[model samples]
Target: MKKLIAIIPLLALCACWYSFTLKPYPDIDTVFVDSFANETDRFELPSAITEGLIGELHSGSILKLATRERAHSVLSGTVTHFGSEAYTYTAGEEPLDFRVTVRARVRFERAGADSPFWDYTVEGFATYPMDESTKSESQAIDEAVSMLISRIMDRLRTG
Candidate 1:
């Protein structure tokens, strides 16, 4: 009973601290994510990137989606590269697994700003086994996109 009472106070204090730190970004409410330009020949990659970023920002619950004219900030980018490599091979010299990497250069600019506040080349990769694994190349690409989106949001929030 004594230990439980001590824990209650600590838990209450933690809750208070958490609420105090839950602050949103200043001077920004909505964002516009432009359709990314695809330098590679991958079909529909530009649409995929745009949708992925919108989904992420919405799910993050920190920013509202807006049109280009109404946005307080804009995010634009290009999918610069994407490729796969045979990562694991069987002793018999057969391919057993693959690793896929996706790279992009992103720019985030605030409204009326002359220069972007965040501009970076970000990358994400995933590895999957060949036959027995249920994961597919499409799924790997989705995972990499999610990773890239998360990293971009992290940079925006931290910066």
Candidate 2:
């Protein structure tokens, strides 16, 4: 009788854990990530952001990558803004660093669904020091892109 009681509690714990770990999009098997629309004046920003997101999706392996026609869901995004501002100054009053920020509206929707699964605006920032070892504009943009991708994934996984 004691062993049975302990086994019941263990089974209950397992059930609760399983339910907690269940993902919302279990039926979604494939995704298509579209080229992002660039509203910013920066050249190649859209391609770079799109490539970064595709890289993340490929690495995650949570969803298979597919062409738009074969996808279970499609993800589209628009770069609403991107800019860099001087963040720090050198001791001689020279520009020491700059912070780059990018904001985007992202939508992930199921194929043929009435509404989007997720729609939101996400922003990311990175600081680039303007020194001998300073990163270039592209590097700063890459960092921001990665940050934005991470935020999107977190929201998707949790919600």
Point out where model 1 deviates above 4 Å: 1-25
Question: In candidate 1, what are the lDDT values of residues 1-159, reduced to their tens digit?
Answer: 999998999999999986775334567888898899999878666688788888888886467889989999898999999988898999998889888888899998887689997789999888777773789988888777778777877776766
TM-score of each prediction: 0.78, 0.80
The candidate that wins on lDDT is 2
When summed lDDT is taken over every stretch of 10 residues in candidate 2, the lowest stretch is: 129-138
Model 2 segments more than 4 A misplaced: 1-14, 17-22, 90-94
Error of 2 at 158 (Å): 2.3
RMSD (CA, angstroms), candidate 2: 3.4
**TM accuracy, model 1:** 0.78
Give residue 49's lDDT in candidate 1 (0 to 100): 76
